[model samples]
Target: MAAKKASGSGSKAAKTTRAIAIDAPPLDAWSDLIGHDRLIAGLSAAIQQGRLGGSLLFVGPSGVGKTSAAVLLTQTLLCERSSPEQMAPCNTCPACVQVRAGTHPDFIQVSKPDDKTLIPLELLIGPVDARLQEGFCHDVHLRPMQAKRKVAILHDADFLNEEGANCLLKTLEEPPANALIILIGSSEQRQLPTIRSRCQVLRFQAPTGEHGRQLLRKQLQWSATEDDELQVDSVSDEALDAAIELSAGDMHVAIRLVRGGGDKIREALWNQLDAPVPDPVAIARLINGHLDSISKDVPKRRAALRDVFSIAVQHYRRQLRNDAKSGEYDPATHRRLDRTLRTFREIDRSANLGTLVDCYAADLTLATTGDRGAIG
Candidate 1:
């Protein structure tokens, strides 16, 4: 009877694992997309009118669902059984499944090289000696292999250098009849004017308030199902509210805050900051340790740090405002707060974070202790 019970438990475990795999969200999960209703309607109208542009640009702040929209567009274009009226792809169709699996012959995705700072010229066009039959510039002109139309998504368009942008311009100026190109970037200014001029731009904004809360709750619930540590249903409204505010409506940041040991690390960091004589090295090391524990990949680590830094800045900014209104405004304190906010721009740069954090901690200590000469 004991052996029989053991076998039954094993069978139940396998069944549960299978259920999770089957229920995993599809690539074109429309319900998963939030806070871009107007943008979705416009894109849907383009599909219904059969006026989808050859080259499209999606510009917005990070984590605002630009790429998700692009993927949904790709599905609508490639699905074997989707109609214009539905404006959504049938996720089960062979073509849709292939697109979701990222194995569709008609779809291409290009992004910045992990080892390099910018998108290389060869990656956009072809190698100089073999430009005729190589790279996205050449492949894009070819007819679709499976779907009715071909789609090419260029991610991290902000990383395009002059040569890369120039190479992409020729294709942008005169794309093939069957090709659709989508470029995703954080802002329009990041791309060359020549590249920007040739594309139809779509803007995405972050979700706010109740809409933001609903999105956060859905995401956390899904995460809890996937990861055992997350207790989405039991988490208090206050904690969820704090996460939402800290994220500033960025979906990616909110998700990371819930799953990336954010609460624990944040509390510890703040505790150290509130110390009578906070040690800069100790605080920097705390952040560095959490970052190291999260990921070995540079980009992921940088993103996690950005979220943490943003939270810290938000906390101090509130205090600054309160102090100002009470006629206790200190110039040094304001300067330090401004500098911390500015550090958000340097996450993608080559600056030394240890030194940066050391300076930030020193500034905080001076501002609170009224020792303006500490930094000097």
Candidate 2:
């Protein structure tokens, strides 16, 4: 059985991230990558100067380009340079080709187990950790193995519980000059202070609905031919809208929602217009649709909804914490966001679903419309 985990929006929705496309072009091919332009530029500059930190923490909402950006940076760092302006791979090169195929000598990717479980102490030691810390470590010590830098990427980095985190921390604290570690966590604060302290943090945000829509179109280019009534443009709007909403400002979430039977949200809508089952305008209605629409006769629906809210709360809290770092959303929005979250916390503890949902949703809508942030 696949490990079921709660996603960032706090939804326990299942995710189906296919094996990365080998033929996909490396970093530089992604120039106008909608949101997080600043992050790209910063990473670009650091690599160009050879000024990148040994250990980096890529933290942000779930879907923004944290993992993708890390992949790109690795490509740039190893690329034989034509110019400093671009540090990622020139995909045509030999090394770049291997990376695209996921067979590069000096690169490794680490994630959780099949149980959708956290990284246990043992897995992090002998097989996964030793391979990177010792084997790859020794190789990179001499010189770049085809590529200039030896790279290790840890995804869902927050899953490294106390023992696992401790092991990685030891390596990160005094990393070899030949090594570069990228830790991609769902949220900044969610990462342990011990881990967060050692690495330079780079934040990623969810790409806009407009940007995500374009990506989906390009990938799933199913045009309406002479024989078919179905068209790519027609199907995409609903998919994109659901993606954007489900992601809750995380690109990863948006993409996942599109994949894991998330397209169901589109069909769930018309019935929801008056009844408001799937797409609830109010918080209570959303909760009702989410938890009540369950038919598999299991706890999956409720658990998934719980997970979604957890992630959403975490994101809202993050916005409030670093008010200065992110200027796009002002302080007022942060305060409003905070109030909404506090209400969520209150609801999370309650057993009575109906009252809790109704109260929280009404409160948030009221807060959003007012200047002083009062829940009417």
Model 1 lDDT at residue 232: 70
Segments in model 2 whose C-alpha atoms lie over 4 Å from true places: 1-28, 80-85, 127-144, 215-232, 236-242, 256-376
Q: Model 1 over residues 128-185: C-alpha lDDT tens digits?
A: 6645345667667666667778888888898887878888888888889899999998
Per-model lDDT: 0.70, 0.55
Q: How many backbone clashes does candidate 1 have?
A: 0
- Candidate 1 lDDT at 130 equals 48
> Highest lDDT, which number?
1
Q: What tens-digit string does per-residue lDDT give for candidate 2 at 275-368?
A: 3122335445645665666534334543445444544455455545576576455554454456545543343233345555555455454444
